[model samples]
Target: MLYLICSVCLFSQSTGGIGIRATESRGAVISPVTAAEPKPELSSDRAILSPRDEYSSGGNAKADRGTVGHILHFSDVHLNISTSRNDSESAAIPTVYGKDAPITLLVSALAYAKKVLPKPDMFLFTGDSVVRGNMTEEYLAEVVEKNVKTMAKYYATSDSNKMKDVTTVVGNADTNPGYRMNLTDPTTEENPQIALIAGTWQDSLSKADLDLFKRRGYLAYALDDTLTVLTLNTLPYSPSHEPNTSDVLDPFGQFAWLNASLAALQSAGQSCFIVGHIPPVISSFGGSPMWNETYIRTYKKIVGQYSGIIKAQLFGHVHSIEFRLPLSCSLGAQFQRAGVLGDDAIEDKADLVPLFMTGAISPIFSSNPAFMVWDYDVTTHDLLDFTVHGGNISSTSGTVDWQPLFKASQEYGVSTLKASEIVNFVKRAETDAKLLEEYYFNSKAQSRLQSDCQDATCQAEWLCSLYWFSTVRDYDACVAFTTASKSNTTTSTTSTIQ
Candidate 1:
């Protein structure tokens, strides 16, 4: 009812009757402009800076009883520095994805976030602060220090008395795990490197979280009395079982910890916001997801059980601006349907939550470097709206100025930050000529300048790859369908965080 009222007053131009989905928080319904549809795909899954009590104007004044809160979210900065050693492995592979982002690009992006978003309550960096390469501890140290230093300049105050309003989780690349490295022609070493990250990031984490993060590569801290930020290490090497041994990549261990953590938060009457690098959904682009099915199902069940307290999920491994809906079935139900909780499992539809994947600062894969800023309700911490800031780059010209591409509430004509509205927008863009063109060019770095999209077919294939948030399977399906429908029609078309 509140959303409908706000939608009419704010988005007066919208047509037809509105459909609303009520959040667990009473009187808070995310208004969906479109009707609810059965979502067949599986769902997927921050920091305390400034204590919760200090949320009101940095504790300068009592936060208006129900004032709105704002925060900035960015990810996949893949900051790659070059080594002078020409013969070294890191030197040989000059880029990951396409080209590693130069430090200047990252600087510009952060400057832009600071300028536009102003003083956000907190800054959330999903993961992958460093690019993968020949990573000796010394080299890794340099990488971590540079990133942390730069981030501190923006997120932290000069005095350093207060903990910075920053939260970072570990990415697969950050740890330089064995499976991620190339052995035959090794670029980075095949070893666990959590210590390098933890030690380097020590000052950024909360005092209580420092030891836990150093030991487990995951940590949780309260942002305020009402909200707790849970940061998880979704990397392959984040040992799955307790005692966290070297042998298994047990998502069970991660889930067990998460379950306990959520219970604690719920008991405290605090809501949760989870941050991680990998998403739980099956990918067709890369091989399989980082986590096993058992882990995913159990994770989803826990999220569902505490859905009342969980606010949002943030991720960035894919380096695209995308979202995954919440889980539909219980872990047991999904396990029963799929037989084994592996890739074969089917994800149920319903009880959808929002999983947002922020775009990368790296110009890899021709994606436009971009970032997002969100407006949220301080009382409920509900994401009210978001805007994508993107920049163009040229191999010859470097990066252009950053600008806002679109705002969700204004452009999409919806009030609430619901998964359905975003999904429907992406689905509609498939046929909406103007929107499809915009989506394709902005999906990757320097896409606007690239000549790869030779024709309509190329455009279609690429759009399909990006369609529905671009999991590996989604990409394969897009290519297949584009190829099959190649002769159908004719059309062609075509930022920076780093």
Candidate 2:
């Protein structure tokens, strides 16, 4: 069984030294920047810090100059087109919990985003546009095209009437026979699955990117002169991938390409956001590694090498909102040995790369359908803040009512959505029950499916998951520590009662 563990030493919070850290890298200093304008307050029952308070807080440094860009991020639509086509007139078809999203819900979600969210400079879709099931390749292509066109229509700029190019990563369910992708070389023998998606996304991808996608199943899009978004095809790395490609060391040569791309970006003095469908971490739900061990190791090495230039690593296969705090294996072991605690433990923030996974728009797993809008510093590409908008499917009014669930910076009391600040939030939450509960609620997108995480086992799992464990052994060590800590706490309480 998979388990998450939090050591007793990891529970203390230090009031001092708890803000974003500027790091010196390659003879240059990289500092966190905040949005020039404050985030608009959205109505919510939970208390939120005012925009004025957030800017004045010592944690976030407001940018004096630089554009603030908004990005709309959506993932795992899982549109069940067949169900919608068959039950066209029935409102009940859209509200069912255990099934993939019907067409009505998908359209409503996109339309709602367009109406409510700020106009985005860029849009992102992290794969799984089609539902998981056996179907002809023709039908599969049709569903994917429908999803693509629908997104294009909603996100099209008013002046140009053309949709902004969407940065996308291929999800496991996007291909036929979910989790299966032909291992043949794309240059020699075309993978029909790859070809289908490339053709469907022609309008959403540049000609160069389309050709690259046809050949390599991945591409990088330049957001500006200084920033790029690298969308990875993570299907081949997943442990559950079909056709048993375990013998293939570097499937589709993606690792080599990735390493080379990041190297070039680093040399060019440009930063990037790495986006993919599946994240390389121990799954909180399954309590197992999501990617093959070999792949995870190589990926982590590449990320560590370019940690300075990589702004964020975004993924969405879990269909839940969560983050992984990056730490080198050696550093994690060192911390574990010394029982490192407090926000001051991490001295160099560059060693930490922020890994965030957004919640899904599909209610298939009983998680409320959700999407997010991110405010980022255009010049530095630092994530300033983000608001998660979720729709409650169990609304008594018989319709999903979408609203702002929470804004990360305001809700978590962080200045910027940088690694250091998030690490501080985690440390503080360890000792604050109220803060931890708020995180638990947001993790599930405020869905009815979420249960109270009052037990030691559940709390430990959630806390430990925030720290990256490169291998199962590393994860097990943390688990053991947490288990022992819980045992000791229980014994102390029992002795007090006696």
Off by over 4 Å in 1: 1-66, 84-97, 157-164, 177-192, 237-252, 284-290, 326-350, 394-397, 423-440, 449-498
lDDT of 2 at 179: 89
RMSD of 1: 12.5
For model 2, how does the per-residue alpha-carbon lDDT over 128-247 read when each residue is reduced to its tens digit? 988878887777778787777788777753455322446457889888888888786755655666887767777655575576687667777666678877878888889899878877
Cα lDDT tens digits for candidate 1, 1-498: 000001001111211111212112211111113333332221110111222323222112323434556667777777777664232443334322377676777778888766665566667877777766767666665776677667767876335433325445767666544224211111222123555666666665545455555555566655666777777767643323223334443422455566666666666677778888877654424434435544454455456556556788877777666555432133223223433233432332214366666778787766778887666666787765666777677455475467766555545444557654554565555455566555544445334654544455665564444322213443344354454444455432210000
Q: How displaced is residue 251 in candidate 2, in Å?
A: 1.4
Which regions of candidate 2 are displaced past 4 Å? 1-41, 44-66, 83-92, 156-163, 328-350, 395-397, 490-498
- What does the lDDT read for residue 442 in candidate 1? 45
Instruction: For candidate 2, give the lDDT.
Output: 0.68
Clashes of each: 18, 0
In model 2, pairs of residues that clash are: none
**What value does the lDDT take at residue 455 in candidate 1?**
59
